[model samples]
Target: MEPEAKWNGSTEQVEFSRMSPRSQGFTKLPGQKTCEKSVLLFTFVLLISVVLWGTLLFLFLTRFKKIAQDVEKLQESCVYHNDSGIVTIIRRLQVDQWDLKNDVPQLSKAVNKLQEDQTTLKSKASQISQQVDRLQEDGTTFRSQVLNEKNTATQALEKLQEEIEKLWTEFQRANGSVCKNCPKDWQLFQKKCYFFGNEPKTWPQAKFACINLQGRLVSIKNKEEQAFLTQKANKKGSWIGLRDLDMEGEFIWMDGSPLNYSNWSPGEPNNQGQGEDCVAMRANNGRWNDAFCRGQQEGWICEKLATC
Candidate 1:
């Protein structure tokens, strides 16, 4: 039997497996609305434009805010640097005033001592000159008489030179060659006792003066040694065992060991010289610098070998 049809519905059934029908019939097919179509297209374009504008605005705002923050950070950094610069200047000026106040008296005393030494040497040299004049007269007289006598006098002249050297050594020993009964603050170590009082000195002058006392400056090797020095230091500032670098511009101890200190001041041993050659401890106990040998005061330090 064939399929039955119902009221208000189509009864025909169509099947097209591999072909198209020439005509089709339905209750009614809904037509596409042209006004609605135009309205949908316009809405899509409006949404796209809005989305594009919003994305661009968001990106622009983000970049502008980041740039503004960077500018503010740069201003803060500049301000911090300015404050630090001012602080450093103030500290330096105060140090300068303190140095001048203390250095004047100490320098005057040193000058006086040097002047006395010069006077004594002058007197001694004058005496030697007079002796030379007399000897020359005697030599002239002897040479006229006997060549053998002048030969004997040469030995006598050598003896006199030796005696003069011995006397000079003895004089140095009496004055500062030995640290006898030094104060507790300036305790002697290995025949060298230091005074950590006032101003920096070139390594050469410090070493040379110390050697005159039959001693050298105390050599610092480690942390303990540096601590001992710091303890004995006078807050007034003084010379320590550090010095100008050797030929290769490498820092070394007086005994020629590599120099490494336990305590150092801020930015120490910068050797700010166009080409530095000397170092001295600054008024601030732990500070140091490389400087010209002559421009600054040759600070005083007395060194004397210990009595065995």
Candidate 2:
């Protein structure tokens, strides 16, 4: 409500009832002008909002089309690369298989050649072994043949020597003119002549008799000669050429031959009385006994190399 204006006796306040209330009020009214100004401001803001949303929608659709084209190109490129890789791998595998097939025949031929060489070597080795065996057998046979020939030659020589000795003995007996060969009474043995005297004599006399006969007192050589002299002994002891007079006990033969053999009667050479130094042969077994050189009279044997 408006306060009534004071009627203070002024000329402007002539009649209060005659004027309208709005005109009579002291404040001015803002009715139709304010409503028109508000409506114009709201319409301008709605037009600006619609223009901005439409611009954003057009930009979004353009970007989405570019992304879809890029995705399709990428898928095509991957498929092409996969096909190329598969073809390259297949070609390489085929080349390797062909190379392996070409080498197999050459390897087999090399193996066959090696086997043939091995067989040839084996055959040659067997031939060499057989030749060696045959050579060994021939050598053994040749050795045996040589031994047989040697034995045959030795036997023939022995027989021829015996016949020559017999012929020489006969020739001396017939001639009897101070023969250069053995005399008639002497016995012939291997390359030597031996004489056995009948009468007994002291050892000194026996030795001198043999020297006079152009020979030395006997020196026994081997068992065969011993047996021969034993046969000629006729159960009588005989003086032979062995003594130890020079050294007392070490006996030696007259011809300076080594005393390699002995046939002493057991306990015979005891050097009894130190006088028994000369050797005497026992007639029974051809074993020798030592006796005094000047004491006993014993038959004696003499020996010399034969003239033939």
Single out the weakest 10-residue window by summed lDDT for candidate 2: 1-10
Candidate whose lDDT is highest: 2
lDDT of each: 0.60, 0.80
Our model 1 lands, by Cα RMSD against the true structure, at 34.9
* Candidate 2 lDDT over residue span 104-153, tens digit each: 89988988999999999999999999999999899899888988888577
Q: Which stretches in model 2 have alpha-carbon errors above 4 Å?
A: 1-181
Clashes of each: 3, 0
Model 1 / residue 66 / CA error / Å: 99
- Predicted structure 1, TM vs. truth: 0.33
Write the residue-wise lDDT of candidate 1 on 1-308 in tens digits.
23344321342332332334433323233444667788899999999999999999999999999999999999898778876797688789889989988899999999999999999999999999999999999988877768656745753664465456446656777776742444454566543455443445555666666555444555565676456565665444545445554463566555444676535567755656555555554553535566555544435344333332
- Model 2 residue 127 CA deviation (Å) reads 99
Looking at model 1, residue 6 earns an lDDT score of 38
